[model samples]
Target: MAPNLSQAIERIDAAHSEDPTKVDIDGEPTPYELIYAKKMSKFLELHTPNPDPLLATAARAQHFRRWEVPRDSYPRTKPGYFAWRTFLKKRQADQVRQLCLDCNYSEAEADKVAALVAKEDLKKGEGKGDADAQIIEDVACLVFLDDQFDEFEKGHDEEKIIGILQKTWVKMGKRGQDLALQMDLSDRAKELVGKALAG
Candidate 1:
């Protein structure tokens, strides 16, 4: 079973104790600060210098914030969701690319990683499936996109990036359509699509 909030908090507290000065709460020690500090420390220890501390923190916060929000509260409008997802994807891709480069991966290898990360398999099957598999796929795709984007910037073909994005959008959009087709979602989905098309 997964650890509850209390257990997770305790673990974070213990990790924070290793670097008391890093912990902060309203300018003093706080649980949030402790967790951040420990996370940064662990990241630095395990990974080479590529994913900047600030970037990693920002990406992590953005990713988790989405998870924290109730599913029902997710933005249903096309433009709204599109913009939000774009922001997240860009950040995730950038971070993963940096990590791949730092690890001495070649440009081709990195692009492959980014393509894998940008995949939209999560939009399938009522959004229900193997949790671990989904997580692995997400990470892989993100890393692939990150690497690919980096390569594109360094004189690689822009068309390749565009093609990848186009294909990914189609796949993701199809899944969205599938989700919208569910008996329970037809009305809301139609409304969202109408709004999206109008916008």
Candidate 2:
């Protein structure tokens, strides 16, 4: 990573460190958002090792200080869920953009990062803007499947789980789908994934 981007990532990481919500990682206490960001970054690296600095910044800061936006604060309806998600994407992009600008990156560079974080124009297989954005989405899906799906499965019913699996599968690329299928998921979860894909 470039020096400026390294500095900006430090800034973002520091902000996430302040989150009050905590999660245990191998018996170590870690801030929830920090772990999430790290997972996103790791997934991005595994998905594509040579991502540009802007994409890397977007991945590492995609959930910057995300605990500030508690899910319960929004209504429990579908529209409310969508609204909160949109708010998070925009907020994350804006925060990362400021960090990039503060670290002396050009406005265009920062804007590209913002666009990637917001996932403004992602497509299947174009270069740069479109493909980079899709990679980020693929990383997110991979992280969710690997890290959060068990917890998420607790609240939703079978039908809902199937729907979510389908939605997540659609967001991912071929590599991510293959990786997910190869995960050591519980039998039930694997069955649901298989069902979703079989459809």
Candidate 3:
């Protein structure tokens, strides 16, 4: 990694260190969003060993300071969920854009990073799916499936779980879908996923 990119990632992690929520990763107590960002980068690396600098930066800062936007700030219903997600996407993208600029990235590179962070033109961009956008989607979907699915499933109903799974599946490429199927989900989660795929 370039020193500037490493510095950007480190600064992002430092901001996330303020989060109170913690999770154990391989027996180490890791801050929530910090670990999430790390997982996202790792998944992106696994998806494409030779990722562009902009794509890598976008992935590493996807959830930049996510804890600052508490989910409870919105309504508890689906509309609220959508609103929160939409707001967070913009916020994260903006934060990443500034971070990239601070890292000495050109405006073109910052714009590309922002677009990926916001997941722009995911399925329809370029009229045939943008490859970089798809890579961003695939990495995020894989990270959620591999690391966050269990906790996510615990709070949602089966119908909601299935709906989310279907949406996530659609965002993924064939490789990501294949990897998702091989994840070690609990039996209930697996059943819900199977039903979602079938439906």
Candidate 4:
């Protein structure tokens, strides 16, 4: 017989009960910690057609880490900040790419997955101002390039796409620099100012 919802929930609870590390202000263990501890069991229980546990876990961890690192502590200089974000983004993209591969996605589909990652607004609905908007736009442009490259590979219109991408890159570069200047960056990050200015 198929398991009932209560039975499934009980199993999840039991798996979590086996280990408890991190906790919230009220002393409740975080779901992520629980998921990490009981990944295998939880994977089996929560198996669905749409989502995979491993991918979900990786994404969740990335999201958690992003917020955990205080923005003030981030690299202040332009190059430093760019390098830091580049490193973080590459790691995140690698994980997503692996997930796509495991899910049997084609190369084109995998590229789309990477593009989506670059375009995603990690800080959506946060009520921030123009700086946030600029970051989002710049990141989206990066994603757009990835997608455009994929289109080029498929023999689609190239000249028009290149022109559009060039224009977008110029606009995003300017906006990124403006946003970067408004914040206090580290000396290392400052080096990225020139690159951002030229972008």
**Whole-model Cα lDDT of every candidate shown, in order:** 0.40, 0.85, 0.84, 0.42
Candidate 1 overall Cα lDDT vs. reference? 0.40
Q: lDDT per residue, candidate 3, 1-199, as tens digits?
A: 2327777777777887877889887998878888888888888888889787888888888777778888999999999999999999999898888888888888888888898999887876226667888898898988888788888898988888999999888778887887778877778778888999999
Q: For candidate 3, give the lDDT of residue 10.
A: 78
List, residue by residue over 1-199, the lDDT tens digit for candidate 1. 2213233234334533544234445786654434543443343333324543322322222222223233345477877677667665565445444544444545554444343334323447466643322433333233333323344434635444455544433433332333323424234333443444344
Lowest lDDT block of 10, candidate 2: 122-131
| Model 4 lDDT per residue over 1-199, tens place | 2213233234334434443345463675565434432432232233222333332323222322343333456678888787767766665556555555555555555454444444443334434434323344553444333322444434635445445444554546454434335534444333333343344
Ranking by lDDT: 2, 3, 4, 1
**Which of 1 and 4 is the better model by lDDT?**
4
lDDT of 2 at 60: 89
Assess candidate 3 and give its lDDT. Answer: 0.84
Candidate 4 stretches with Cα past 4 Å from truth are: 1-26, 31-76, 120-199
- lDDT assessment of candidate 4: 0.42
The number of clashing residue pairs in each candidate reads: 14, 0, 0, 11
The TM-score values for the models, in the order shown, are 0.28, 0.90, 0.88, 0.31
Better of 2 and 3 by TM-score: 2
